[model samples]
Target chain A: MISALRTLLLCALAIAMLYAMRESMPGYGDITAPIAVRGAVGERVETQDFAFGAASVHLARAVKVESFGRVKDYSTSGVWLIIEGAAVAKTETMTLMSAEWQAGNGVRYALSQRFSTVSGYLPTERLEPGLPRPVLLAFELPETAVDKGTLLVARSLVMPLAEELSIALGDRKPTEIKPSVTISRSAGGAPWTLAAR
Target chain B: MSEKRTFWTCLVALIVVLPLAFVVRAWESLRESQWLAIHKVDIVAEDGAPQAFAGGQWKLLDMRRLPRSDDARIILAEFEASPTDPAILSQGACRVRLVDGKGRRFEPVALAEPAVRKMYPEVADRPRCGALAFTDAKGGAAVRMAESFIVPAEARDLSLRIEFPGASEETLVFRWTRS
Candidate 1:
């Protein structure tokens, strides 16, 4: 009887250990989380899918876009942050579909959808292998979150386990916040250009 | 003796059978998802010959590289498919791409940029691989397709690949002589 009881206890112990192991396994989100590639502003960040280099960052109160002889002006209560970068696909032709501004306090702001009609937007343009093209990303964020923010770029925002490039904007704040900025989209000249308004 | 046999059988099932069953279930799930399935290219046309794939004969007609001012070049690929079975046309749109020797896959440029349109106006009229299959071709006629890609000037040894998702598990790879 003692032997049988001991056997029962051992069986229970094994079942408990198995249950604990199963419970400790990682969740779906944890298992399929994005692989992050980190870099700093002004430095070229290369991922398995693409290469990106952020050249400049502009902070403005309002934005004016000139495209196809039509000018559209946009104003936001929050500050307008414009990111100018160059992106090239590493192997295939693909679109960079996700851009977000991650504030220092961990708040994330997606790229503005208001500029969807504007040409040269990074997310809408197709990227080709070996051909680097200029890309622009605009984000509207609270003034308090402008300093010490990071820019995140990825081929997709919803794809699990995809590569994500994070470019840190650094701790310094901008010296000048333009009252208005104009983005001219001309076919004969560069894809688009930014100027103070 | 009967109790000993029962204990051993139960122990064996707990140690091995349960985990094996879970693994088999996971494998089936992955295969059913198709996204995680291994892409095995079954048909390869290496000698510039037409290949029978997806109930059709596929041939790479022409391929050329056009030099641009920058470090990038435009790769134009023209292909054709002569269907042996008309059912292949209704099998849904096909996915096509260019794969280099180094395992780099290039998707076709969707939008016609001004530079590419100015250089190759004829390409603008030709349908892509997906649309070509559904074009107004009657009586098993050959459907011509074209696609353009902006690849790095140094990209070499490129080949075309076409895949029909629900119709066939095999992928068709066509190699072309560079002109």
Candidate 2:
């Protein structure tokens, strides 16, 4: 009985050590995720977007959203980041999926609840297989998170076991990143091209 | 004796660990649930009852309408020290009035002795219905004032104008339309 109890304790300790080591690893969330692809602020990537090869995504441009309306100015204790682009379906009709803003410190912030008009309706927009639909994603983030947060676009808000794309928000400065449009996919597949707006 | 010792050891361990785990979970829940509870209570009370959000030198904490058969809407407004600027939440001379979109003004109704005695008999006779109750605490002072008005059905845009001593008058507007 004593030997068996000692063996059980040793096994439990071994499992705990492995869990701690896994937690300490760098890029832990990305490494364990099913798929994680990264692209620059301007560089566009042609990949399976948000799922197990659901649709092909070509991100056109991303800019910081300051205001919701022309006259009405909305101010919060935190900063607002907006990414505008287009998504085209590869095989079937596509509905916009949820995305999260993952900060450098591994804090993920959901879409702001206070600003419903922008965050609520963006994901419900539909995209045809051939035509590219415009996508606007807005996230309200703390000032600390604006410096080094990556935009992770996925199908479900809490998406699991699916390949995810990490789009870096800021290039030069923390609060502001210039919007750029440069398309260069190494795979070189002509699936869809977003029309100039 | 050995078996009894082992049983007692395990029981003591369970007793200590269970309450420790519960305390940790309760602390975590209180951190998130406290703010959610305050906002939820505010929204629910305002939906069924006559409600108003007073924005001025002091922040409005709570407001409720006392149901009376006389058809007059008696609004009880509770004000607290504004987190942004607590200095403005002071005891001073003040005047509060309600104005309609067409510039019709309505003054506050004085508290009736018979109504106070009937409903809130436990309340001190010194307290009035539409009078400001100023109390000082460790952090700052809090001021609560109630007002009564007869709002007609056709009143479009209504606002509460509060004027404090040596301070500019602030207007809290209420939208009559759905949007």
Candidate 3:
């Protein structure tokens, strides 16, 4: 009877040890998460694939995109955040395929698809090595989530073990929001400029 | 005593050997699936000679650098491939890129680009590296291909790398000095 009890106790101890190990071990998602390279607005962050710098962040009530002699206006119930930046591919030609606006409260907002027709949308623009190109990303977010936002940039949404840039947008007051903004798309390696209206 | 020894061996195998083998296999699979995984055999071209790779003969016909209005330059690479086995064409498109001395890689620009169309009008007539399979060419007929890239002016010692979907494990590299 004593031997059987001792065996049962050992078995229980082994099970407990396994349980502890399982809880402490990193999960698949955590192990494969993108390597994040953090930076602030206006600071150039270099990753394994590319280098990116966020030049300015603007908040507007509405956005007008001028593409190929046509102008399209996009108005949102929430505020529109325009992020102007430059991206340079380091080793190969690539595109910034994913961008997200993470609010201070941890709410993530994806890049607005309403302006997909815009020719110079950042996510749609191709980046070539050793050549710097202007980037413009627009996100629609609630008014409360405007201040203290962080822009998350990555090569792809599902990339594993790739570098991601997290650019922090400093705090801004409600008064800084503009009434309207216009983005003029340029042609043939020209930089796109944004104007406040 | 023999039965006792056999029982202990079985226990050792179950408790240690089996799990070790499984862990090793899983680790290998994870490494292969990672983003930085590279599994390619490289074949370098010497003296502009044609190379045999992926059941085809590849040769670099011409490489030229053209000055652009801007500081950037255009690299036009023209190559040809003669397939020994025509069935390889069905394996999908080929990927060709230029690597500079500084390890920067440049992908081919669209054939419809204004510069490519204006400077190399014949490029529009030739099939791209991977599009040869779609043509009605029989085996051993050399099909010409062309690619153009916009590169920085300082890029030098350029090499062209070609990859075919049919031969996923092999790549051909043609090296040339900027003249």
Candidate number of the best TM-score: 3
- Per-residue lDDT over B102-149 for candidate 3, one digit per residue giving the tens place of the 0 to 100 score: 999898877545776787789745667775443666758887888888
- Give per-residue lDDT, candidate 3, residue B171: 80
Per-candidate interface DockQ score: 0.61, 0.01, 0.73
Q: Per-residue error at B9 for model 3, in Å?
A: 10
Looking at candidate 2, what is the lDDT of residue B127? 33
Top candidate (DockQ): 3
**Once model 3 is optimally superposed onto the true structure by TM-score, how far is the C-alpha of residue B15 displaced, in angstroms?**
11
RMSD of each: 4.7, 18.9, 4.1
| Local distance difference test values of all predictions, in order | 0.83, 0.48, 0.83
DockQ of predicted candidate 1? 0.61
Worst 10 residues of 2 chain A by lDDT: A50-59
Look at candidate 1 and give me any clashing residue pairs. none
Q: What is the lDDT of residue A35 in candidate 3?
A: 88
Q: What is the lDDT for A175 in model 3?
A: 55
Superposed on the true chain A, the predicted chain A of model 2 yields a TM-score of 0.58
